[model samples]
Target: MLIDASSVAASADEIRAGAVSGIIFDMDGTIIDSMPSHAQSWVAFVQNHGIDIDVPDLMRRTTGRTGAECMRELFARDMSDEEAWQHIAEKEQLYRELFAPIFTEVAGFKAFAAQTRARGLKVGVGTAGDRHNIAFAFGHLKLPTPPDAVAGGDEGLAGKPEPAIFLEVARRMAVPPERCIVFEDAPFGIEAARRAGMRAVAICTSHDAAQLAGPHVLAAARNYHELIESKFLERLHVEPA
Candidate 1:
């Protein structure tokens, strides 16, 4: 169901002519190149608990899921709320420690964000990462401006492929689902955006363009630099502030 880049480019006029008014970004892989650290943390966490798992397989299954959801899936057992939270906290703490020194934004993301804001478009972040990870990103990245809305997994929203997180972010941004575009790095996230009735651009950071392809994906790019160079954002027809 994946369309080619040319087709997406051909839809530029339609996108610019009122089809999109907001942009929602997924945090870990899409906004920042921290998935390696995340994967390592997951491997370390599972091994520490004496569980054996293939890191890549585990990552694919849990990429867009909440920590609690991931634990249940990983262990194949139901857990009390308190136990789930404890494990999530521990795992995320390890992830932070591993990623702290090397944290970096995806190439050209900051500039693109600034341009989007200058065009007066609503901007939001929707992520399966918890509040602590969110705080870590804000502290390290030092974004030029805070997002208009942020919907995180710790907020008790259903995770990706369910549409709840993206839907909530759109709501908080005061934009309708059909009028927004989502940037994502995972298949589940792409599905979530489509289920929320929005267009999506795949960020091929953690996965290749082929792996990220799907019917709802408008385009695929390695970073914002490519998106800009290819006129992807120009297709949105945002005017200068």
Candidate 2:
């Protein structure tokens, strides 16, 4: 991984030489600090419903799954899409209410995304979050501009740990998967990037670096600020496309 100056510099050189043209960010923990709120919402949702489920374990299991996938996994049963979304909407509404007052991006996330665009790298979001959650995050984040492309969970793609979501983002960006870099905060996302044949940079917002580590991971940082400190952006030599 790009943990030191030389390695970070080398990876930048490799990136430039590799002609990496697109960067896909996982929405929840990578772009915004929403994981904690998600966890809290789950606890509240279950408590309200008088369910005896293990919330933390549920979070661990469902972190990178689609809402329907999460619901099915949570209850360990197959569910119609309409039935799944009904539950998902209720839980996510709780999440939005809990998160709205405290919404914040990972440190330097906006600046990092802006820098990528300035360097001519297309920025996209590949997220397990559904469309409503996407709107919720953006309504609060207020990025300087929207991503070049976005692939949300509600679109029927299999979620992280599956390459479909990230691959779709690459397709929408009109960039080959091998020419994209995925910024992710979960182990499932790192694996998804690998499956998509894209390089990965782990944003360790919730999980430990060890949990997110993989051969495909070029770097792991607590936030974009650390990546900036590593001078990663400065070494990128991509020009406007």
Candidate 3:
């Protein structure tokens, strides 16, 4: 369901009144503008194996899923766990290679992360990317220090549209799900956040804002810069440092 801007504001107000204390972010599209690179890598990988799948369909089906899950879904065949891991590793290596030179964070993300930390809000990462991808991101991107907690797909957590990853992040951060707000770029991640009993803000990095809209979302922004400009974080009533 597409929510109007007024409804977004209302949801933000409601979340503020509810006392949000922590924030969880999804990595790929939410923190870094690497979706296109990722999609390109997927296309290259599949084509190399003589598989013919549309890039858009690949992205839509796999965005918030682990590489192993994505591989299985894309191939529509079962493989041994070892075989799955091998495919995941190779594909992610390709992703890292393709993404390294052009790596960039979402606009205003570094400053916003620092500010969120300064404001005493716990920060957590809930992502479907494996640890290698997470390491690559942190090692290459010009962002703030690592988040207080991280829950990745490699941890055996169920991927997005299922609440396990988000729930695990909230747990590791010592924040209750109800008091945590999630920042996500995919519809599946938004659904996962809501299912975990948290409010979500959509980062429209990969999809249009309207495509991301749903009842559980508080607002949608192109990047953290827009959120900051509009005082969206302030509306959460985070304490000053």
Off by over 4 Å in 1: 1-11, 237-241
lDDT for model 1 = 0.86
Which tens-of-lDDT digit does each residue in 147-216 have in candidate 3?
A: 8899998888888889999999999998889889899999888889889998899998888777777777
In the range 157-226, model 2's lDDT, one tens digit per residue, is 9988999999999999999888888999888899999999998988878987778877777778888888
Output the worst ten-in-a-row residue range by lDDT, candidate 1.
1-10
TM-scores for all predictions:
0.93, 0.93, 0.93
Comparing 2 with 3 on lDDT, the higher-scoring candidate is 2
Candidate 3 displacement at residue 68 in angstroms:
1.3
Best by lDDT: 2
TM-score, structure 1 vs. true: 0.93
Q: How close is candidate 3 to the true structure, as a TM-score?
A: 0.93
| Candidate 3 deviant stretches above 4 angstroms | 1-5, 9-12, 142-144, 239-241
lDDT ranking of the models: 2, 1, 3
Candidate 1, after superposition: displacement of residue 21 in Å? 1.2
